[model samples]
Target: MRDRKIYILLTDTGTVLTRMIRLYTKKNYNHASLSLDSNLEEVYSFGRKRPRNPFIGGFVKEDITNGLLHNAECVIYSCTISQKQYEEIQAFLNEIESHEHSYRYNLLGLFAFMLKKEIRRKNAYFCSEFVATALTKGEIVQLRKPPSFVAPHDFEEVGDFQLEYRGKLASFYHNKNHSYQLSLSS
Candidate 1:
């Protein structure tokens, strides 16, 4: 019997990577086993101990890609690394891709797509139009209107801020001298 081939999807964000892995396992690997690791702890420790430099960080990402490529059939990278680090991973993959013993693998970045307005609004702030459209149509609508210019540090207006996505709805609250208000909801 042929040995069951395993595909590994690697990423810094364990949650998203695990979700992808679960989806893949359900679709392709009913009998095959899977594993998930965040590697965030190690990354945090290394970042704290090592000098803050791109070359060292690039080497770390390269090492991870190289090690995983040795045994896995394919690798899906889903990290928020810079382009230089990404290039280093690609270079390592190119070196391994030539080997006949190796399985086909790919390195992917999580933030490959530009931050579209819809995703930004969904994640950053709650817009009524977004909520109504998403609720009514069951689909996302891109913010077609041009965004007004606002200073990055406009705390009073809350131009845009990052918020965690808990589920279908996201909420953000701001507190002032005398009153508190919810600014964003989706």
Candidate 2:
């Protein structure tokens, strides 16, 4: 834990598309983001580049105050991993972020999940798939299902990750305290 940290940021997003997804899945959240830090300054996910439009998604560096995530309701979980794992995750993220143009949102995978099917597309991922892949690659979690089949709500089922924060993204992002050790309950 000296050299690395990993976090899962699950957001309801409060966008029309996410709201529509919530209605369909009857779940608490519809979007997922992964971060190597607690402040979430480096959050990454596959989602709309522009919040207003549900379309046009790819590898994105996410922020709480930006476009879709502004004031979004979210739950954040923190996990500790070894230095070796951290380096591996960092390398993967570096590659992905540097070549972000090579990736796209997996709309077909999302549809397949809704239909209780599995579809894997190279260089394509949805929000949860991306995060799940990162966590899996980091050896933080052994995902029994394909990353594409993983949903935002699924992360909550695991007991290992610590629920560090829950509430509006703005609350944690803009907290005057500037600490990640907030209360477990909002």
Largest TM-score belongs to which candidate?
2
**Residue-level lDDT tens digits of model 1 in 41-97:** 111001101223212211121222222222222222222333443344344334433
Off by over 4 Å in 1: 1-77, 102-186
Steric clash pairs (candidate 2): none
Predicted structure 2: clash tally: 0
**Tens-digit lDDT string for candidate 2 (12-108):** 8777788889988899888998888767778888998776667888988886776668688989888778998898888888988888899999988
RMSD of each predicted structure = 20.8, 1.7
Badly placed stretches (over 4 Å) of model 2 are 1-3, 176-183
lDDT comparing candidate 2 with the true structure: 0.84
